[model samples]
Target: MENSLNSIFISLYAQRIQVLFAVIGVTITCLVLYCYRKRKPGICGNLRFSKVAYNSITVDWDRACYTTHYRVFLRKPLEGEKWRSFKTKNDTCSFTIKNLPINTNFVFSVCACNGTVQGPLCKESEVISTQNLAFKMKGISILREETLPNYIPVYDVPFRVERNGQLKVRKVTIGDYPKGGAHQVKSILFVSIPHSGHTTHLQGVMNFIFGVSTKDDFRLGFSSDITKKSDEYKNWATVYQFVEYEGGRLDKPLTLVDIPRMHGPKKEQLMMIHEQLKYILELYEQRLDCICFVGPANSNNLSPEEIDFLESIMYLFPNDQSSDLSTDISCFFTFADAGPACLENGLKSSSVKNFKSYFVNWSAFFRETNEFSDSFWNMNIKSLDNFFNHLNASKPKTLRLTLEGEPPAPQKKENVWKLQPEVKEDVANLQMTKTNGENFIDNKTKLTYNLQFFVYNGGNQTN
Candidate 1:
């Protein structure tokens, strides 16, 4: 009996050992399959063009499965030619190739990537040609309407003047007197950061000048249809156009809509803003004839970095405050209170008081009239005047425009398209130097790059 019991126990132990071995064999097989099985990122699909601009083309593609990112290759079709590789984040489906040589053809291809390893080169590719449309061809001319409306449009009247060698604000006035009166006005946009009282002060100016209280009668928002609202609002609606930005808001300012979400230091944020501003200016270039930049004195609470950024913008577009009649855009730097008290105390006490010496001799545009107290409009006009002096010194030669009230002259559209003179230099560098096979800049590098191209061009290049 004891021998039979021992035999049973041995049989059970052997069975258990065999089952454990079987489980281990299955696990090992799975592990081997997972390691060696094809781990390629999904194949790239149709590459298409979303937009073709004067010096750039926006390329888009269908996202590949399991792709951590996409690698872009630019090739100038030739025998045994290698592609110029670029890259975009996995979530980014489109990339804009900027600073491209005009009137040239290039083939573009995309491949999926898994971490550092890229999948097979996409079989599908797209052929694109860059063209300088702004320079090569004339845009369709828009006709101005001949029939005149009965009401005097606010925009018809220019509110810019050269005062004591500074660019100063003029009272918002009618361009002409109404013969059979009951005037009409067109749309106007008040561009400024919030809490500087630009809206409230502009309201006072409009009411005093127009002789009717339309303080609450304006539309608020950015719109492509400023001309459409002329008939609806008659004339007063134009003076009430105020688009608000920044003031106790955690969200981004409306002016920063074109900029991408940013990380890193404050300087990075300013740089991105600068780029987006350039893009915005490009989009509205042709339509900027009547545009104005109105910045109030109290809004001068700009940080040193912010001041530098603004100064760069002024250098890029010095004609922002051009008083020329044929000017495409004008910049208006105003005081918080346009009265006498603010004028004296302003230059001496404002946040920009220390830096007010920069704008000394430019035109001084004021906001106060007889209806409002000169004391009520307390602003640092002198400091602002000095500020314009500095602007005059740093202003670039290429950006200068013929002053308004002076003769109209031919100006190059290229200047508007090119934000800075260095763009050409950067492009020339890219073409002159041949990239070795390791031209691909890894996504991890915390480097600033141009919007259209991924290559580093020394310091940060504006859009």
Candidate 2:
């Protein structure tokens, strides 16, 4: 009887264990099914910027099937601050947020919501700001001005430096624009001290103003054949005529012919340079309207000898020329006399008393940060813009003509023509001209000329 009782107990225990396992497996299956039925959907994708302005930006994202609405979040990345959020209707995927700060960087993200349920935030977001908008638009106007024949180079840069310590200069005839034109062109030359980064900075300023790189800007084709062919100066010669000095010092006069000799020239050699430079400037003055001299701050301060050289060139070249040559042949002057390379207080050149001089600060771009501080690149851009505008400054005049979007009602009487109001077409037309207006057609631009004022502040030109 004792053995049979023990067997029964063991069998019962085994049966109980089997039942427990079966129940546990069934419970696990039910739990998994319940979780699957209530899973959350994913967030939207393809977030982008549709439009950007000085005070507003329009952002959009891809639509999600389960989403009934979307939430947009924005904040300035540089300023570690709380995010500002907004909502958009389910049917609407784009939101034009307004009343934002100017020149401030912002990052945007979006999240999707399905009535009571919300999905995860978008994996990608757009970073944008309403800065440089005006600069971009202003570049189009400058591009239009550049199309006129006068704005084109009247003479090619004299010589191009070669990599193998050779100078390549060919005698190519640069032709003038047709006899008659609506506007006069002004020519300017920019020369810099060695290793000042002036060339690079000037190129950057041009790119910023025109809103284009060398490859994209159509005007780059107007560069001289030597400039386009020269690897050492292809980009520098694109916008302005770049002149480089090979000699150790500029305290004495020099010319392209004298640049081959790296050693210091004696007094007799200096006299020869003076004569040759005078002759070259005379030739250049016939075509050039103004000449800009820039000395970028470098490791070495501007030596007294260099200052003497610059002064001699500035005063001696333009003013000491034969007075009876031509009444309109004087070259207006502008100089960046001081920079990080030299910390001199002021410049006094007996030859040029009224020219413009700027003490440009040193600012560089950092690739690791992918940005320039507020006082750096942006400051450079502003300073350059101001300087260029000053070069072409003209008083603004009021026009009675209305843009395409305005009502058809006539404004006050003015000499301006009654323009047809077609905002969309006009804007598109302007953009097209800015991109492709390098050709001179009958000495004038094919694009419509909207601005009424043309200022020639740099040089003198008489018809």
Candidate 3:
């Protein structure tokens, strides 16, 4: 009886031990599943470098669900350096790494973390090279008046073309207008930097708008070979007049003034061109419809000369209080060979108020077809049609011709011609004193008065 009782006790103990073991196994499995659930969020997605500077970079990534935070790891792949880690808060999606070496290639990866559990790392980002800070430091240095000897107002010097002969002005009647009919008038000024293909583009514009071939029109007086004598082209501002008609009735009479390239060897010559342009506009006695700047579509940034030209335009045509009188500024880009990125960069870098830019890939299209081909002419017509349509839809502001006493402040004094209304009386008084042979004012004041008056009166000789 004692043996049987011991066996029963052993059997009961064995069954109890088996049950305890099963419970322990189930508890371990449950713990494992819980730990896995905490780490199942995911690695960050779409990791990219948002901004890159000389010594710093900003990395951004999409947020993951159930993520408490993100950890970014950066390293120089070329140097085989150990990764440097940075942690961000749960709401943060971007991290900026600073004090990094410039002009170095960098790669980065990001991972998500839920409290203590970390998720898998994302695919590494493409290598990005930091910028060279030295290029940013280099800037255009301006020469001061004191640095130049015998510095005189640029307007005091006559244009080489004016001295050689009367500047050529051509007029043509375009459109189908019935004789003895009233017509509206519109004027546009075209300005550009050197080597921007301004003349060719202007010829295309004239052909498109007026259906007149300006290429061989001797009356237009455009340089026969601008490439061979670019310097001569810069010495004169070619002017043209086009009278428009619609349905046998007179319409807008368009005056297209092709200003000389705003860049040249002598700063004085550039200023002279600017002043002469102002004089020409004053003679119009009407507001300009647009001042279009022609440039290459591949340009990513404006040169110092281009910037100066833009600032001069702002001074010449200030924003009037009336919306109707505000000058419409536009940029025309020719030969879009570099693609949209360059165009976007150009627009972003332009300092003009109304950032309207138009472009045509004429060079590219022409390369595939002959000049006499229908497609070549159609392309030019279509591009210009779109540009004009946009201009009409936008209700381009009219540019007032009268020079204001004060213009928008300029970065360089040489870029603008400042005038005061009181100067008119002062100039009259100075002239009277000079006639009387009396020293009414000091030489410095007398010269200032004469210079200011000279520019104020459209660079004309005052009586």
Which of the two candidates, 1 or 2, achieves a greater lDDT against the reference?
A: 2
Residue pairs in candidate 3 whose N, alpha carbon or C atoms collide under 3 angstroms? none
Error of 3 at 232 (Å): 6.0
Instruction: Give the runs in model 1 whose Cα sits over 4 Å from its true position.
Output: 1-38, 124-126, 133-463
How do the predictions measure up, each by TM-score? 0.24, 0.32, 0.42
lDDT of each: 0.41, 0.44, 0.58
Task: Please give, for residues 5-72, the per-residue lDDT of candidate 2 as tens digits.
Answer: 99999999999999999999999989975654354546788989988765788998888765567788
Q: Tens digits of per-residue lDDT for model 1 on 282-357?
A: 3334112222334444342333343333333333333545523222222344543432322323222212212222
The lDDT of model 2 is: 0.44
User: Which candidate would rank higher by lDDT, 1 or 3?
Assistant: 3
Clash pairs, model 2 backbone: 150-185, 251-309, 297-340, 297-341, 298-341, 404-421
Worst 10 residues of 1 by lDDT: 245-254
Q: Candidate 3: TM-score?
A: 0.42
Native-vs-model 1 lDDT? 0.41
